[model samples]
Target: MDPKKIFTTILIWLPSVIITLFFIPNALDKILHSSEMNKIVSNNAILIITGIFLLIATALFLYNRTIVIGTILLASYMTLIVFIHMYKGKSYEVAILIVMATIFAAYIRSPFTFQQKRNY
Candidate 1:
């Protein structure tokens, strides 16, 4: 296994699992404090749906068959998080953005990916 892919998968998987634990309450707080999350996914139904997607994405990240999709999902998620922070006029831990960007780069470099058009 590529060391970078291993690192990226670990990075995406951990926080995704952690976020699933607090999705509802955190969404509630976001809705109260910021307008972006509410605007994008206001109702509990959408929140639940996205939350479930996060959970499943993390699980898929654990298996080889579904990892690219998981990386895409997680990358898009973290991008949105960065956007949300900017939209709401706030800044967040730079580490988060850096991690997200690094995972994205690692996924692109992963030898298991057909899109890379190379073999390890």
Candidate 2:
């Protein structure tokens, strides 16, 4: 593979992997009612629903065809988190960082890049 393609794949896949890993454990905590999530959300129903959404979003992100949708879903979720954190008078830096990183990766991996069309 071309070095550029390899780099782009790394940029996309690395963050995707990291984001998925980040969300999975949190999702599990919510579903399993673990202490990690209990400190944040108290409602079981909300936790379960959020956890399920995270799993689905991660699945969508990992699959090439659904990556765009997955990015949107995950980004939206993260954005919501940012607001929630701010509302609770907590730092939202992590959520904001993830959202920005995900958007950057999505741009880099976008199928509609000008170079692809020009190469055809």
Taking the tens digit of each residue's C-alpha lDDT, what string does model 1 give over 5-105?
A: 99887775565444444443544444344434545556755665666666666555545677677666666776777777777777755536644653554
- Give the 10-residue window scoring lowest on summed lDDT in candidate 1: 18-27
Candidate number of the best lDDT: 2
Each prediction's TM-score versus the true structure: 0.53, 0.77
The whole-model C-alpha lDDT of candidate 1 against the native structure comes to 0.58
Candidate 2 residue-wise lDDT, 5-91, digit = tens: 888678767766777788789788778874445457677787788889888988887777887888899899999899989999999
* Error of model 1, residue 19, in angstroms: 9.4
- Candidate topping TM-score: 2
Badly placed stretches (over 4 Å) of model 1 are 1-41, 93-111, 118-120
In model 2, the runs with Cα more than 4 Å from the true position are 1-8, 34-36, 39-41, 111-120
RMSD of 2: 4.2
True-vs-predicted CA distance for residue 54, candidate 2, Å:
0.5
